[model samples]
Target: MTSLVSTSHLQLAAFALGTVGWILCTFSMGMVEWRVWHVDNTTVISSGIAWVGIWKVCFISYLHISPGYKEQFCHKFSGYDSFIPREIYVAQGLLLIAMFVGLVGLTATVFALRNVYMGIAHKTLITRFFLVGGLCYIFAGLCVLIPVSWNFYSVAQNQSISFPPSYYMPTSPAAQDAGAAIPIGIVAVILLLLSGTFSLSYRFPVATNTTVNPDGINLPSAVSEQEQSQEIRTTSRVIL
Candidate 1:
């Protein structure tokens, strides 16, 4: 007989994890605040504290004289920071695209699970559809990964030493670290990959009974022709 319980749990788990990753990635993409790290300025009056994101940047002042948030302002990319790291832009676009693609994948997976009992043909169709959706998840993860990775590297290099000269860096003494979004994106990638692998690993259950149908054929006959011939010869010898 056929059973869905065995693999259903695993598939559902993978789907749930992938969905969580998707939500995190979406949040990260839209979030334009809280960068990996900011310049560690000693003086309270000094304005080095900043929160940066892929789409926008901001400067926060926490001067000692006016502690408790006297004034804080957020600003968008003004197209003034050197040549503007193109990687961020690319990442932004990719993440957005991934979100949409992942949506389609999730939809396919849900429907595929539902149609599992529609016979071998339907099951095969579901398997293929799920695989395609998994591919989309993977692609979307990659899209999120590229930009996050590039940004992390760029920030590290800039913070480590003056490679592109002083002007290229974000002000001076600005330390860098991995942002929250980076990890979120990484998690999403892992989940997406797992979801895809699950889809590919799905195996159609086999039955010992033979069935003859145009669209269906139970593989591996119960007894091969050679085995049948040998059995017949043994029977004749026993009768004699």
Candidate 2:
């Protein structure tokens, strides 16, 4: 009997992890909390906290003229703002690229996994897809890793960005910390890395149909008895 082709459980696990990582990556990209700054004055800013992200900066504050109610305000980053730090600017570009690459990686993994479960005969092509997917995932993880590390270093040093006066934010935060997005991105990167390693582990299993001869040598069960006897006779003639 021919050996049965089957899906790799490791790659299936990899696909699950990569899918979760991709979702988290998307969330991290949109989240406006790469870094959080806490300020002393809550009278002007109700929340007394400011959020800075690759895409925008936001804070909750009372309307200056009508001070009874508070509202959240956000400023979207635009071309060439001196106030925005270079690290954030760099993160914007790199994270976007990472998201795209991760998407490609997920697509490739899906195709490979589907083909495997469907028992497609094109094993070589499926393996190539898995390799490409794994490489894409690793590259994507590295891309996110750069920005996450850069931002982490900045946070450890209490890096601050200057806001315009009209924004009503303090010149600098009393305290700053890395935000939810940073940790989320970090975890997502880890998952993607693991997924890449797992995806690369695809291998075909050896055939299970074998029997031990009287001499204790293992022989494939598919070998005909007539062929085995003929081989044994030939070997005996050679020995004589």
Candidate 3:
């Protein structure tokens, strides 16, 4: 006779936290206008003149779309009209893969919940499911982190070593800075790490020794009459 399983507070909390981190990480992926330039060079003084993202980069509307303030306007980049950079392409692929793995992790987490299954066999299965989910999240975190960190490092004036001649990073005034998405990705990675760690360490199936009756009497209070009589006699003998 199977019954509804109860989920512990710890299990629910970890799942919620992990899901939140995944959402934030995905949101950060779409935020563009990264690596904008703020130059005080004698030749130019442009502010927020470009838009860069993991997937694409474009110059802000320089013509009369929503003119006056270029910083307030954005233009769409296309494969036919604009040349896309290689690093951005790499970033896009890795970030997409990260999101895909995170989706798998979320799916596994659903089955890992205590209320989802209630047998000894299921107990072990759920634990393994959660363990796999946690590892996937860790992988997802690394995937996003790699691109974000690499992009930042590539542009950092003090830290940049020369890029290979074939895969050379272009010297753009815009490359001198980071973007809004950078901090957001950083926070997401931290949350994912914490959430996965907590999920991995959680102890479910707190009780290991569960006694079930062989005669279809599953209730703990329902024992054999002979056993009850023996228990009573043993109590009387102790009293005497």
RMSD, candidate 1, Å: 6.8
TM-score of predicted structure 1: 0.72
The 0-to-1 C-alpha lDDT of every candidate, in the order given, reads 0.66, 0.83, 0.64
**106-204 per-residue lDDT for model 1 (tens digits):** 887777777764333455676777787678777777877788788778767754322133222244445666777777777888888787777666775
lDDT by residue (155-214, candidate 3, tens digit) is 575222222232112335533578888778887788777767766875554433334556
Provide the TM-score for each candidate, comma-separated: 0.72, 0.83, 0.65
Candidate 2 local lDDT, 1-240, one digit each (tens): 232234478788888888888888888989999989899999777888999888988888776433443487777788777888888888888889889998998999888877776767576878888898888888888888888899989888887677887667787898899999999999999999999998898875554588999899999888999999999899999999
For candidate 3, list the clashing residue pairs, or say none: none
Model 2 scores a TM of: 0.83
Model 3 lDDT vs. the true structure? 0.64
Worst 10 residues of 1 by lDDT: 160-169
Ranking of all predicted structures according to lDDT, beginning with the best and ending with the worst: 2, 1, 3
